[model samples]
Target: MTANRTALVVRGGWEGHRPVEATDRFLPFLRENGFQVRVAETTEVYADADALATTDLIVQCVSMGEIVPEELEGLRAAVEAGTGLAGWHGGIVDSFRASSDYLQLVGGVFAAHPAVPADEAPAPGEEYFREHVIEITEAGRRHPITADLDDFTLRTEQYWVLTDLLNDVLATTTHPAEPGRPWRRPHESPAVWTREWGAGRVFVATPGHDPDVLDHPSVRTIIERGMLWAARGSG
Candidate 1:
């Protein structure tokens, strides 16, 4: 018999690339690979007890907002008991900054958008959403989720995150400021990582800045395997 796996997908915040678009792309991918998927456009997952209890995985696509405490607790309970939690870009890690507990749960926060500078507003030319090559860090190559993948190009927001010494560094990319660019510095940053929280697992990739970018082979493979591994946990 095929094992039944369920995932609750929550999508919202920052309508730029459209969270729904990203969820739409992944929901079918999960279903095709043997998962029953449920989609929510709001933070309702943070409330419904029955919905939270039955899920085997939680996929968040939210950017930033306030989450209800009960819902947060419910998710915490479900995951701690072995449910998987996975997401990309701002939807998972950078979504809820107001809640310290939420930040603690997700493992990191948005430090800066290299494409979008601090002082200047994002105009047409100022944005860095072009196709760029991403070299997998040595650690990433060893991780099951990223192993076997080659260096690939993606047209997405390369996220620079501020972490608190807990994540298992899996992959990274370096950003050096150009002479004509907005800033003046070079920082080698972690692009992906995994961490364990109780009986559950968490995997994050900072490169899913756009929906189309998810179509790349290297990108899709990491996300799919990461989600599956995070859901299964030490299995």
Candidate 2:
């Protein structure tokens, strides 16, 4: 059995994403997998270096929240010292928009999600969001987090994110051109990816908009394996 592994879950932000509900779904999974789970509803925990020193993995869910400089530094230091950081959707990438340091560590930015034209757009969370397939990349098929997983389709908010080559993209989705938008051509974005920062690993998947999506078999499996793959001393 894995010995005394600590899983720190920091979650809270926009209620639209149901941070509490989403993270709760995985709490048991973490415990079942031999994690000593601790829950914090704020980013202030990131500022505690000593606390982070013992952490095996961090599951963050602060969607579009603000993070101070010292907190970001301490978090980076902990990760660089071998603590794993893993998260999904706006909870990770779209967080702390004001902190580019966080962006550099995570290696992706939340750009925009394509919506239907102004005139035809329905109330939020309706048909405006597209149903697209998530295609696993060659690299993903070989990665522990996504190995043996086939491409699947889900209807939720499909994120059109901005990413750099520093990310090892595991899955991708195409954004069809919206006639009235700034861009008129179809473009692709990374749906799932991982990055190695210093001595640590960071994993992100862009599929969890609603709590239900977090329960999707494919989404849940990827995230579960991802958290393990990013942990310190993990194979």
Candidate 3:
């Protein structure tokens, strides 16, 4: 029999996490789970009018960049037509700052990352690098993606997003940069969240920062489950 699903992977932009490396790790997982995967290097895949019609899922690893309107529309239409879309880190949310339509569809956009200090700041080269301890929210406990996982931590980027359209938030991580300092504020960040866009499933994990980041057992498990759930009712 043919594979049960089709996953289209698009990787490009900022080479920090090595988008290709992440996609490399994801390919086997998809195939073992019975998905025939297609790999693309640009947003142009969405330019095809019939693109999403045959896609089971769209896995994007592209960082901040410009995308053509036709390409963006094709993607929008695909998801609206019931194709699953999944992404991690800045690739999805922080992408296309000029496109309000894209940002609205993604639910959240990256604002200032105060934790990442500026170069001319008093701290200079010093950065707020710490072990991210995440707490699974109440809604996460009922979801298959985070069902058995307990509170976990990872050495990765902790996203501080302004989002309100998520359906089920799978996990949250808090960053405490200071103690008792009035100017310092504690932030509760969302590490993983799932939402629905039109008739399709949208899953995003804002944790992947490097090759080893995904190596974390908890991190890997969550991403795996998110992929599956995002592809719900499709093949």
* Model 2 lDDT per residue over 42-87, tens place: 9999999999999989999989899888899999999999999999
Q: Which stretches of candidate 2 lie over 4 Å from their true place?
A: 1-3, 117-124
Q: Where in model 1 is the C-alpha error above 4 Å?
A: 1-3, 116-126, 130-132, 180-185
Return model 1's CA RMSD, one decimal: 3.1
lDDT of each: 0.77, 0.90, 0.79
Query: Which lDDT tens digits does candidate 3 get at residues 1-235?
Result: 3587788998898886588988899898988887889999989999986766888888888888789999999988988888888888787777787898887777777764445434434353225444568789888998888998998876556777767755567888776656443446677777788888999988888877776877888888888888888884743
| Winner on lDDT (2 vs 3) | 2
Better of 1 and 3 by TM-score: 3
Sorted on TM-score, highest at the top, how do the candidates line up? 2, 3, 1
Residues 86-196 of candidate 1 have per-residue lDDT tens digits of 998888877888888777877888887656454456667448654456777787788788888887876667777877678888777767775667657877677778888
Residue 127, model 3: Cα distance from true site in angstroms: 3.2
Q: Which residue pairs come into collision in candidate 1? A: 46-71, 63-95
lDDT of 2: 0.90
Considering every candidate listed, which one attains the maximal TM-score?
Answer: 2
Give the clash count for model 3. 0
